[model samples]
Target: MEYEMFIKKSSLQQKMLISFLCLIVIPLGVFGYISLSISKQTIEEQTITSNLKTLGLISEKLDIMASDLTAISNIYFSNEDLRKILMQPSVEKTYEERAKKEFLTKMIINFKYAYTWLEYYTSILGLNGFELHTFYDGRVEIDELKKEDWYQEAFRQNGSIIWVSDPSPKLARTVSEEHFVSAVRVLKDFESGAPLGLLMINVNESFLFQQYAEAMKDYDQLMLLDANGTIISTTQKSLLHQNIKDTKYYNQAKNGDRGSFKDEIDGKRMLVTYHNVKNTGWSIIAYTPFDKLFANIYRAELLIIIVFVIVLFLSILVSYFIANRLSVPIKRLYRSMQKVEMGDLSERTDVLGTDEIGELGRKFNRMVSRIEQLHDRVVAEQEMKRRSELQALQSQINTHFLYNTLASIRYMLLTQTAEKVDSVIVALVKLLKRTLTDENEYISVGEEIDNLRNYVYIQKARQDGKLEVEFQIDDRITHAQTLKLLLQPIVENAIFHGIEPKEGTGCISVKGWEEQESLMFEITDNGVGITKLETGGAADITEAILSRGSGMGLRNVNHRIVLHFGEEYGLKVFSQEGEGTKVILKLPKFVKTEELISL
Candidate 1:
C-alpha cells in the first residue's frame, strides 16, 4: 500500500529518478552483500571438498595396497613346496636338503621387490617353527615373533587380515628408525582348515604421505586418525601415535559430517575441515588459520562498499538531469494533446526542436491524416483472410474426392472384372460425394472409421488379398469428434512398410480408446518393422515425402492432423528391428457441436 501511494504521488520525472536509483543502487547493494556472504562459504567449501577428495583417493589406494598384500600372502599359503619344506622336521634335513629352502627364499625376495609399495615381508611358519624373512635375518625363530604386539593381536582376529600402523622396530631391517604400516594375515590350509602360519607385508609410512603431498601444501596441518581417534599419520611427525579424541572437530568427523568450522585449536584460531576415510575408518583432517582462509572476503566487502557509495551519488545526479530533460518535453506535448481533445485542431506545441519529441509531433499529425487509409486497409486484410480460409476448406474437399475416385479406378483395373464390382463402385461414389459436400474440419469417430473401412476395402483388392486388418475401437469414444482422415494414412503406411516387407502373413490392427481427456489411436503391425526403413523417432512427414525409402503416407497424415488441431495432437511412432511397428495418434476428445460443424 505504501508503494502504491508512492507510485500515485510521484511525477514522471520524480519516478524516473527513484526507479533509476533503485535499479543501480539496490542491485549493487544486494550483490555486494550476497557476494560477501557467498565468497567465504564458497572458498571454505571448495577447500573442504578438495581435501576430502584427496583423502578419499588415498584411502582407495590403501585398500588396493592391502588387496595386493593379501594376494601375495595367498600365493605363499598355497605353495605346497614351501609348506612341505617348512613342515619337515630338522633332523630329517641336512645341507643337501636346502634346495627348497633356498628357492623359497628367492621367491619371497622377488615378491617383495616386485611391488613398489611392499617394503618388507615375513612368514612365521608354525609347522617346524621356522621364520622366513625377506629383508631381515632369516634365522629368527617363530617363538620370537610371538612376543610382538602385531603378531599377538593378528592371531586374535582368527584368520582375517588386520592393518597395524606405526609399528615399533619397523620392518626394514637396515632402517629401524623408519616407521611402517603393516598388514598381518594368518594362513590356513585350503582343505584342512588347519592354521599353517602367519604372513606380514609392511609398507613404508613415507610412501603414503608421498601420494598426497601436493594436496597437503595448502593446509598448515594434516592428520589421518584411526577409528579410535589416535593419530596414525601426520605431517607433524611428533604427533604420530598420539590420541586426538579430545580435539574439537574429531567427533563431528567421526559422526560423518564433512565441513569447515572456525575454532581455537591449541591456542590459535583455525579453520578446520575433517572427513572420514570410509574404507579405513580413519578421518583426514586439514587445518589453517581463520584469518588466512577468509582474508579475501573482508577485503572484497570493503572495496565493494567504497565503490557503491561513489556510484550511488553519481546515479542520483545523472538520473535527475536526464529525467528533467525528457519529462519537460512530454509535459508540453500533454498540454497540446489536451487542447486537441477539446476540438482545437489548430493547436500545436511551439517548443518543438529537431529531437525525438519533434519527430513524435510530426508523426502524430500525419497519423491523423491517414486514419481513414489505415481503416480501409484493415477491411481489405480481413476480406483476404476470409477468402484464404474458404480456399483451404475447398481444397481439402477436392483432394479427398480425387483420391477416392483414383483409388476406385485402380482397384477396378487390378481385378480385371466387371461382375460383382458394384460394392466397390458404390462405396467410392458415396465417399466422394460425402467429401465434396462436407466442409467441417471435425467429424464423429464412428463416421471417420466407417470411411476408413471403405478405403481399406479398396486397398485390400489392390494388394490382392495380402493385407490382414482388424479394428478394436472402444464404444466410449465412438461419439467423440476428431479431425477427419487421421487414421487412413497411418493404416496405409503400416500396409506398405510393415506388411509388404514380410514373407508370411502380416497383420495390421487399429485400436481406439479414450485416455486422459484425449482420444488415442494405436495402429500396430506385425511385419518387417519400420526399423529397416528408418530409426525410431517421429519422422518429419514433410521430409519423409521427399526422401525415398522413408514412409510416405505417414508424413502427409501427420501434417493434416497437426494443421487441423495443433502440434500436441499428432503422431508418435515406436518400432523395433524385425519385430513390429506401432504408430499412436493423439487428439483432443471434443464432442461434435453445431459451432464446430459450421466452421
Candidate 2:
C-alpha cells in the first residue's frame, strides 16, 4: 500500500490516541540520547581539567619548596665560620685545619636542623624526594658525598638551577637502586654574591607513574612526555623512556594540543585525550577503550529504535479514526460559514466534541452575536453626539450676545453726548457679560484684558470713582491664551466685599507680566482691605469651588482654565487682615489655535 493510504486507513479516534502517544514518546527517546551523550562528555572533560589544575597546583608548591631551601642554604653559607673557612686556602695549614673542622661541625648540625624543617614542608606538599648538594674546589658533593650528570650539568650551567631533567643516576648513595627526575639550584653569598654550592631535589619516577595510574584507572593506557616530546613516564613501565618519534603520542603531543582521537595501542582500539602543561613543558595523556565510553549510548539508541518501530505500527492502526473525528467538526463549521456568507446570520455549527474544534465553534457564534449588538450601540452613540453638539452651539450663541452687548455699550460711551448715561450702561453691560459669557471658556490674554478693563470701569462707576483703577500689562504677553473674564470676578469681589464696605477712596491695580514660561496676572486692592477675609477665608474660595459650588462664575473660570492648561495654571488668592488683598492668576503661555494654524 502507498504510505499516505497506509496512514489514513485507521479510525479517527484511534489515530488521535496514537498521535498523542507518539508525541510524548519521541521526545523522551531523543532527550535520553542527547542527555546521555552530553553528560558523558562533560564528566570526562571535567575530570581531565580538574587533574590538570591539581598537577599545576602541585608544581607550584614544589617551586615554593625549592625557593625555601635556597633561602636556608644562603643563610648557612653566609655563617661566619663557613665563610672564613672557604676564604682561607689549605696553604695556611694550622688555621685552615681548625677552621675547617669547626665549620664542618657547624655546617652538619645546622644542615641537619634545616633538613628537619624542609622535610616537614615537603611532606605536607606531597613531595616524593628532596636533596641538598655543595660544590667546592672543582668537586660536587651532596650530603658531604655524591655522584654524576646532574651535578656536572649544574656546575656547567654556572651555578644556575636546572628545574627539570630527565631520569638520571641517583645522587645519594642511600638511593642507589633508583633513578630520579630532579630540580637543582646553587647557593650564593648574601653580601659578596659569591657561589657557595648546589641544592638538589629528586623525585622518584615511580611515584608519578602511580598517580597517573590512579587518574586513568578506567583507561586502557596513559603516558607523560617531556618538552622534546619524549615519553618520560607511563602507566606501564615498558613504555617509559620511549621516544615520541617511535609512538603516536609523540607526534600528537608535539602539537601542544588537547583533544580526542581514535588509535590502536597495544592491539586494542582506543580513544585518547592529550593535554600540555605550558609552565613545565610536560604533556599528560589519557586513553580509554572505545567500546566502554559509547557502550551505553549504543544500547540506548537500539532501545529507541525498537520503541519507534512499535509505535509506528500502532499509529497505522489508529490514524483513520482520529482523522475523521478531527475533520468532522471543521467540515460542519465550514458549512456554517457558507450559510453565513449567504446572509443567514443565525447559522451556527453543532458542537458535540469537547476539544479545540468544539471551542472554536462556540467562539465563532459568540463573535457574531457581539457584532450585532455593537452595531446597535454605534447607532445610538451617534444620535447622542448630535444632541451634545446642538447644546454646545446654543451655549456659544448665548456668549456671542453678551459680547455684542458689551461692544455696543463701549461704542455708545465713545460716541454719545450723554457720557454718564453711557458709563452706567457700559458698567451694567460688563457686569452681565462677565457673569454670563461662555466666551471666557478659551480666550487670549489680550481678550481677557479687554474683559477686565470693562469690569474695572464698571466697578469704579459703581463706587462713583471711589476706587482708583491702575492697569499695567506687559505687551510681550498680550497674545498668550487665558480664560476670558478671569480678572473680572476677582476685581468685583475686591470692590464689593473689600473696598466698598470701607469708607475712603481705595487703590485697585491689575498687572500682568511673563515670568519664565508662565504668564502671571496679579490683582491687588488696597481699599478697606479685607481684615477678616485676609486671615483664613482667602483659601476658602477653592474649597467653595470644589464643595458648595456657590461662586459659579469664579468656579467656572477656574475649572475651565485648569481643564485646558493643567492645575498649575489655576487661581490663587492671598490676603492679610486689615492689609490688602492679592489675587494671582497663573496661566501657561500658549498661542491661540487661530495663530498656530495660520503659522
Candidate 3:
C-alpha cells in the first residue's frame, strides 16, 4: 500500500522531465547568460593591459635617451683641458687665453661629429665671462643669464642634469623657430669643487617624436603629460603645451601610477589607458572609443541568443519524447508489480526494444518466475517440518517427571502454607511449559539458568532449606545461546551426589561465563566427595554415574551438548575424598537470532 502511494505521487514521466530541466536545460541557459555578460568587460580589460605594455616600451626608449645625454655631459665635465680653460684667470691679453680658445673650439667640433643627434651644445664659464658652442662665438655673460629662471634652475640643481622642455632666452637666440628639449647641468672643477660653468645639450622635439606620433595615428590621441597636467608632446599639434588641469582624465591619471577606465570625453564614450613615466612624474595616455572595442562582442552575443532560443525550444520537445519513451515501459513494469503483489505472479512485462528499459523488463519477468516457484516449495516444506517438530517435542519431555511434579504439588498444598504452595506451583508450571514447547530449540543462557533455578527451588523445599545455591553468571554471556535444560543436570548432580550425602551444612554454586567463543558452566559443591575406585581409578564412579537416569544425568547432558555443538564440547569432572567436587560444562556459544534452525 505504501509503495502504491509513492508511485502515484510522482510518475516516471514527470520525474524524467524535471531532471532534464534542472540538470541540462537550465544549466545551459545559465552558462550562456553568464558568458555573454562577462565577455565585454573581459575584452576591455585585456585592451587596457595591452596599452600599458606599449606605454612601458615608449617609457624605456625615453629613459635611454635621457641617460645617453647625461653620459655625454659627464664626458665633457671630466675633460682636463676644458676644466683648465674654465678655471683660468680673466685677463684681456694673457698668453694662456689664445691657446685656450683654440683648444675649446676643437673640443666643441669633436662633440658635433661624435653625436649627430645633438642639434647644438653650449658651455658658459662662471668665473670668466666667456661662452663657447658649436654655432656661436662670443662671451655670453653668466651674470646676465643667472638672473633667468631656467639659468637659476640649472644653478640650483647643484651640478646634476635637468631636462627642461621650456627653452631659455640664450637658447631661443640660437634656435628661436625650432621646438626643442634640453638637458642642462652646472659644471664644476673636478679638483677644486669651484663653479666651472653651465653645459646644455638640446634635441629637436618634433624629430624625436615623429615616428611614435605617426604610429599612434591609427588609434586615438596619444600624449605625454607633465607633472602640472600639461601636454608636453602629442600626436595633435594643437594639444602641445596645453594644460589639462581642469579635465577629468587629468584628475584620474594623477591619482594612480597606472590604470584604465571608461568615461565620456566630449560626448563620446572612451576607454582611457594611462601609465606614469619612471623618474619624470609624466604620464602616457591613450583615448579610444568604447564602441569600437565591444563591436565583436555584441555580434557574438547576438549569435548566442539566437542559438539559445533554438536549443530551448528543441529541449522541450526532446524532453517530452524521451520521458514518454521511458515512461511507457516503466508503467508496464509497475502494472506487472501490482499483479505480483496480489499473488498473480504469472504477470509479465512485454519487451518494447533492445535498450535499458527492455533489459530491465526481462530481469523483472525472470525474478517474478523465480519467486513463484520458491513460494510453492516453501509451503510444502513448512508443513513437513511442523510434524517433525511435534514428534521431537513429545520425545523431549518425560511424562514421569510431570506426574512426580503434580504429586509433589499436591503434597505441598496439604502441608505447606498457601503462599508457599502458590509459589512452588507457579514455578513448576512455568518450567514444564518452557521444556515441553518446541517454539525455540536454542534459548539464552540466562533463560536456561532461570529454569534451573526453579528446579533448585523444588529441591530446596525437599531438603528443608538445608541446600544453599549460589549463582554467578557473567552478564555478557547471558545473551548467548545454549541448549534447553543443559545446565540443570550438572546442577542436580552437584546437589545429589556431592552435597546431599554430606553430614554438615553443604553449599552448591553454579557459575556461567564465556571464554574463547565458548560458554562454560561450573557446578561446585562442598560435600562428601567421590571416593577413590578400587582398580586404580575413582571409587564407585560407575554407580554414581548409574544413579542419574537416561534423561537426567551428567553423561546424557554431555552427549546432547556434543551432539549439538561438537565432541570438543562436553563435561569434565574433578573430585576428591571429602573436600569438594566441581563439574565444568563447555558448549559453543550460539546466538539464537543469527543461528536459527528450522527444526
Candidate 4:
C-alpha cells in the first residue's frame, strides 16, 4: 500500500520509469532462472554419460593387454627347445654348456624379434641352476622369489596362466636402476607332469595406460586397480600400488562390473565412472568434479546476467528520455506562471510541443501579451498626464520671461528713442518665437546661434556699451541638431549675474564644439564672478546658481537637458570672486530625432 501510494504521488516521468524497470527486471529474472535450471540438468546428464563411455573404452584396453601377456606366457611355457636344454643331465650338461648358453640366446632373440614392446621375459634351468633374461639379469635369489606371494601363487596354479602386478625398484635396460614387472609361470613337462623351470615374462609398469592420460584431460583422475585393490596404473604417479579398498570410489567399483555414479569423495562432488576388465579383473575408473562437468553452463549463466543488466540499463535510459520529453514542457510552463505571479507580465512560454502542453503554452504566451498590452496603455496614459504638467510649468516660465522683457521695454519707451525701442521689440519677438512656441523642441546649431544673436542684441540694447558679446562656434557642427534654447538661458545668466555687476565693459563669449560623442558649449563673461564662490567650492557655487532667485532659468535648462538626454548630459557652472562665471552645456550630438522628439 505504501509503494502504491508513492507511485501515485510520483510524477508521470517517475511512474513511467518504474514501469519500465518492472518490465525489464521481471522478464530477466524468469529467463535467467529457467535457462540456468534446464541447462544445468542437461549438462550434468550429458557429461556423466560421456565419461561412462570413456571408462568402458579404457577397460577394454586393459583387457587386451592382459590377454596379450597371458598368450605370450603360454607360448614360452610350452616351447620344446627350452625343454631339451633344461632336461639334459648334469654330467652331460658340462659337455653341453655351449648348447645351453646358445638356447638362452635364442630365447632372447625370439622375444625381441617377435614383439615391438619387447617385454622382459626370463627362463631358469632349475636342474643346473642356469638362468637368462631379455633386459636385466636376475637380481633376486630364486629362493627369495619363491617365497614371494605372486611366485607361490604362480607355482600353485602349476601351468595355468595368471596376471599379477609387479611394482618394484625402478628398472633400466642398460644399468638396471629401474625395476620390471613380470607375469611368471612354472613350466611343466607334458610327458612327466612335473615342473621343469620357471617362465617369467616382465612388463614395464610405466608403459601401461600411457596413451589414455593425454586423451582424458577433463577427468580429474584415471586409475586402473587390480582385483586385490592395488592401483596398478594411474595418471597420478604417487598413487601407484596404493591400496584403495576402503575408499568409497573402490567400494562402489567392487560392486559393479561397469557403471557410473555421482558421489562426494574427500569433500568434493564427483561424477565417477568405473569398468571392471573381464580378462584381468582390473577396474578402470574416472573421477570428474561437478564444477568441471558444468563449466559451459556456468559461463552461459554469467552471459545471461550481463545481457540482462545491459538491457535493463538501456531500457531505463529510453524510458527516462521519453518521460522527460513529456514533462519538461509542463515544468517550464509552471515556472513561467510563477514569473507572471510575481508581476512579470513579459514572461511567455516557448514550448515546442504540439500536444495539450503546446496548446497550454500558446495560451500562456497570448495571455502574457494581452497583460503586457494593458500595462503599456496604462503607462502611456500616465506619461501623457506627466507631459501636460511639464508643459504647464514651461508656460509659466515663458510668461515670467515675457513679463520681465515687456517691463524693460516699457521702461525703455519712457526714457529712450523710438529706433532703439523698435530694435529691442524685434529681438524680443525672435526670442519669443524660439522659446515660447512649441513648434519644435530641437533645432540645428546654426539656427540656435541665430536665436542667441537676437537675444544678445536685445541685452546689448538694455545696457548699451556696458556689455559686449562674441560667438565662437565650430562651423563643422553648424548643422548638428540640439535643443532650441540650449544656450539662451546661460547667456542671460552670464549677462545679469556676471556682466551687470562689473564697472568695465563685460565681454561674453559663446563657444560651441564637438567633444568625443557629445556637443560642448561654454558661455563665459569678463565681469564680477559669483561672490558666494569664496564661501564654498564648485559644488556649492553650482548649488547657489541653481537655487538662486534669477538662476531659475538656468535650473530649468539643466532639467530639460537631463530629461531629454540623460543625467550625464547637463549644465555645470564654475565661477570665482574676481573672475567671471563659466557655464558649460554638455549635450548629445546627432541624436536620432524620432527617439527623443516626442519625449
Candidate 5:
C-alpha cells in the first residue's frame, strides 16, 4: 500500500531529468569557469611577484658595488706612502718618485683587481657599469685627475661617506659608452681629519633601464626616476630628464612609499608598481598595460560565450532524449499505482537501467514487502492476544488451589497447634508472594535455595520430623541465575507426592551443581515412589515437564522456568515404580546483581 502511494506521489521522469541537469551539467559548467579564472589570476600574480624579486636582487647588487668602491677608496686613503707623498712639497715628490710610482702601481693593481671582481659580478647579475673615480686636493680623477661636478660635491660634503648622484653622462676612458647613476663618497684622512679624496662608482643606467623594460615587456610604457622625481631613464631615451611630478607612481614614490596602482598613462590604462631604494633614493617603476594583462581573460570570456551558445543548443536536444528515457519508468510506475489503488495488491513497478529511477523502483519493491510483513504481524499479534486471554482465564482457575491452601492454614490456626499453624501460614505467605510478584522472572540459584528452604521448613513442621530433608548445594552454583520459585515447587512435589504418601520413613534431597557451562538442580526422594499406572497416566507430570500447569506446584515452576530460561532449561523427570522420582532442572549460569534488588 505504501509503495503504491510513493509511486503515485513522485514523478520519476521529472526528478531524473532535474537531478541529471543539476548534479552533472550545471556543476561541470560552473567548475570549468571557476577553475580557469582562479588559475589565470594565480599565474599572473606569481609572474609579477617573481619579477619584483628579480628587480630587488638587481638593486642589492648595485648597493654592494657602491660599498665595494668605498672599501677600495678607504684602503687607498689609508696608504702611508700616498699620505706621505700628499703631505710633502712637489719638489720632494721628484726625489721619492721611484717609491711613489711603485706604491701607486701597487694601488692601481689593487684597484684593477677590485674592478675585475665587480665586472665579473655585474656580468653574472645581468648588470653593467664598473667605474671608479677619485678626488685629490680639489679635483676628481678617472684615469687622470680632473675636477667634475660630482667630485666637487663629494669634496664639499667631506665627512659624508656615500651619496647617490642623478643620472649623468659617462666619461670616455672610464665606463665605456653607457651613461650611469653614480654613487660618490669622500675619503677622509684618518689622523688629521682632512679630506683625502672623493670616490665615485657608476652603475650602468642602460642595463638598469633594460631590466625595467623586460619587466614591463607586455606594456606600452615604463620609466625609472631619481630622488628628485626626474625621469632618469626610460625605455625611450627621449623621456630622460623629464620631471614626472604629475604622475601617480612618481608622486607615490616621492612620498617615500612603495606600492602598485592603476591609472591612465598617455591615455592608456596601466597597472604600475613603484619601489624606492633607501640608500640611493632611486625609484624603480614597472607598468603593465591593462588591456594586454587581461588579454587572456578577454579571450577566455569570448570562448566561453561561444561554447555556452553551442552547449545551450546541445542541452536542448539532449534534454528531450533524457526526458524521454526518464519518463518511461515514471509513466509505468504511475499506471502501476493506479492499478494498485483499484484493489490490485500484486502490482509492481518494472524499471530498468542503473540510475536514480532504478533505485526508486527497488525502494518501491522493498516498501511493498515491508507492508505485507506488517499485515502478517498484525494478524499474528491478534491471535497471540486471544491466546493470552485464554491463559489468563486458566490462571484464574489455578487461584482456587492457593485459596484451599490458605483455608488449610486457617484451620490449623483455629485448632491451636501454634507451631504447625505458624509454619503453614508462613509457607502460604511465601507461596503467595512468589505467585503475585512479577517484578522479574529470573533469579539466582542462591535465591532459589532460600525459597526451597522456606518450603522445606513448612513441610518439616507439617510432617512433624517424620521425613528428613537434605540439601547438597555446590557453593559455585549459588551465584548462578535461574527462574524465581524454580526449585521450590519441585521440592514441594517430592515432599507431598513422592515422600508423604509412603508408609515408612522417607528422605527428600535437593541438590544443585554446575557441570561445564550449565547449572543443574535435582530433587530426589527415597520413598514408595510412583506406581506404573499413576506414572503412565500422569497428565500433570507431562504438563509439568512441558511447562504447562494443571494448577499444581511443579507445573507452574516449570512454566515460569521455561518462560525465563528457555525450553531446554525447564524440567526433566526420571522415575522408577518402586523407587523415588528425580526431577532435574537445567539452566544456564547467568548471575546478574540486578536480580537481588527485585527479589
Candidate 6:
C-alpha cells in the first residue's frame, strides 16, 4: 500500500520511468535467470553423460582384459601334463620332485611364448602334496594352508576363478606380488569328481590401471572391485586389496550393473560412475571431483549475469530518456499557464516541437495574447468613462491659457476695430463651447477640423497674422468619426512654440488619411524643431506639438489609441533641429463605439 501511494504521488517522468523498467527489466531479469538455470542444468547433465560414457569405455576395456585373463586360465585346462601332474595321488610322493621342475619349465616356456601379454606369476597348490608352483621361490606350510583366506575363498568358488588383489601370505608370492592382483581358481578332476589343486595367475596392478591411463585425470580414480566391494586393481596403489569405503555410491553401484551417483569419498565430494566387468564379476568405479567437472558452466553463468546487468542498465537510461521527452514539454507549458493564471499576460512557453504538447503551448500563448488585448480594451473603456465625467471641468492646466486668451480678446477689443474683436470673441466662445461639452468621445473629422480651425483663428488674431494654418485631410474621410479635441492641443502647441517663436510667418499643416485598416494623421510645422535639451525649456511644447510618444498629452493619446485598437495603432514622431517636426498618429479606421464595446 505504501509503495502504491508513493507511486501515485510521483511525477510524470518518475511514473513513466518506473513503468518502463517494470515492463522490460523484470521480464528480462527473469528470462536471464531461467536461461542461466537451464544452461547450468543442461551442462551438468551433458557432463554427467559424458563422464558416464568415459566410465563405459574404461569398463569395456577392463572387461576385455578380464575376459582375456579368464581365457588364459582356461588355456591351462588344455595342458594334459599339468592336469595329470595335479591328478597324482596324495600318498605318492615320488614324482613331486620331478613334477616341480617340469611344471616350472612349462611356465617359463609359456611366459616366453606370450611375453607381450600381461605377464603373470602362475602357481598351483594341490591336495595330497601334489602342488606345482612357478610364482616365486618361496614355500608355505602345507598343514596351515587350509586356514589361508585365499585358499578358503578359492575353494568355495568350486571351479570358477576368484579375483583377489595382493593375495599371498601362505603361498607366499615374490616381492612383486605385494603390488599384484591375481585370479585364483580350483582345478578339479572332470572324471573322478575330485579336487586337484588351485591355479593362480598374477599380473602387476599396472596392467589393469594402464588400460584406462588415457582417461584417468589427476583428480580422478579408477578402481576394479569384486562383487563383494573389495578393491582388486586401482590406479591408487594404496587402495589395492582394501575393502571399498562404505559410501552411498558403492552401495548403489553394488545393486546395479552400471550406474552413477553423487557422493563424498575419502572426504572429497565427487561424481562416481561405476560399471561391472562381466567376465570377472568385478566393478569398475571412476571417481571425479564434482567441482572440477562443471567449472565452465559456472564461468559462463557469471558472464551472462554481467551482460544482463549491462543490458538492464542501458534499458534504464532509455526508459528515462523516453519519460523525459514526454514530461518536460508538459511541465514547461504548465509553468507558463500558471504565470498566465497569476495575471502575467506576457507569459509564454518555450516548449518546441510539432507534437501535441507543442501545439498546446502555441495555443496557450495565442490565448494569453488575446486575453491581454481584451484586458487592455476593457481598461481603456472604463477609463474613458471616468475621463468623460472628470474632463468636463476645463482642465486646471489650461486655466492660464484661457486667461491668456481672454486677455488677448481684451487687447483685440482695445486695439482693433469692433469687427476684429467680435471675430476673436466668437472664436473664443466656439472653442470653449466645444471643449466643455459632455458629449460622446467621438466626433466627425469635419467637426475636429472645425474645432482646430477655431483654436488656430484665435491664436492667429493674437499673433498678429504671423501664424498660418493649413488642412489637407482626405475628403474620403471628412465625415469619418474621430476622437473630440484630439487635434486642438497639437495645433495650439504649433502656434505658441513653432509659429510664435519664428522671426517670419510660420505654417502648421494638419493632414489626415485612411491606410489599410487604420486612420493616419500627420502634423507638420515649419519652425525650430525639437532637440534633446537638459535646460532649454519647451520640452512640454515639443510633447504637445509632435506627439513624440512620451510626456502626458501625446503619450496618453498614443496609449489610448493602442488600447482601443491594438499595438499596430500608435503614434510616430520625426523631428530635426532646424528643419521641422512631423508627428504621425495611427488609429483604427473609423471604428465606432458600438464595435469597440462589443469587442
- Total backbone collisions for each predicted model: 1, 12, 3, 6, 0, 0
Residue-wise C-alpha lDDT for candidate 5, range 299-338, written one tens digit per residue: 8878877887687667656875888776878788778778
Displacement of the residue 284 alpha carbon in candidate 6, Å: 2.1
Q: In model 5, which regions exceed 4 Å deviation?
A: 1-40, 84-106, 120-156, 164-174, 206-224, 231-235, 254-258, 316-599
Q: How does each model score on TM-score?
A: 0.43, 0.37, 0.42, 0.49, 0.40, 0.55
Off by over 4 Å in 3: 1-33, 88-106, 112-127, 135-144, 173-177, 214-218, 245-248, 255-257, 298-599
In the range 236-318, model 3's lDDT, one tens digit per residue, is: 87777778989988789777778888789888899888888765567788887877777788888789888878887788789
Clashes of 4: 6
Local lDDT at 436 for model 1: 49
Best by lDDT: 4
Computed on alpha carbons, the lDDT of every model, listed in order, comes to 0.70, 0.59, 0.73, 0.74, 0.62, 0.73
Expressed as tens digits, the lDDT of each residue in 384-465 for candidate 2 is 7544543443353255445655565565566645876576576666545554544334567877787667666655554555
Ranking, lDDT, top scorer first:
4, 3, 6, 1, 5, 2
Error of 1 at 545 (Å): 99
Which is the better candidate, 2 or 5, if ranked by TM-score?
5
Candidate 1 per-residue lDDT, tens place, 1-599, comes to 99899899978989889989999899989988888778888987786677677666766775676577778877776788766665566543567456655787799878777786655555445546655666555454556567787778877886887777654553446234366666677767666776667766666657667655777777888887776787767798888778879865787666664656677888888877776655556677888876777778778777887898889889998988899888888888878778767656566665566898878877766654465467678779866764565345335435554575567566676666765366677766666554545666577999989987886776665566688889999999999887666787677678767788888778889999999988899988987865534433554333333254455456656666666567777787777668787888887777855433323
Candidate 4's error at 249, in angstroms? Answer: 31
Candidate 6 residue lDDT tens string, 310-352: 9889988999899998998988888888998877898888986
Q: TM-score rank, highest first?
A: 6, 4, 1, 3, 5, 2
Local error of candidate 3 at residue 389 (angstroms): 76
Q: Which residue pairs overlap in candidate 5's backbone? A: none
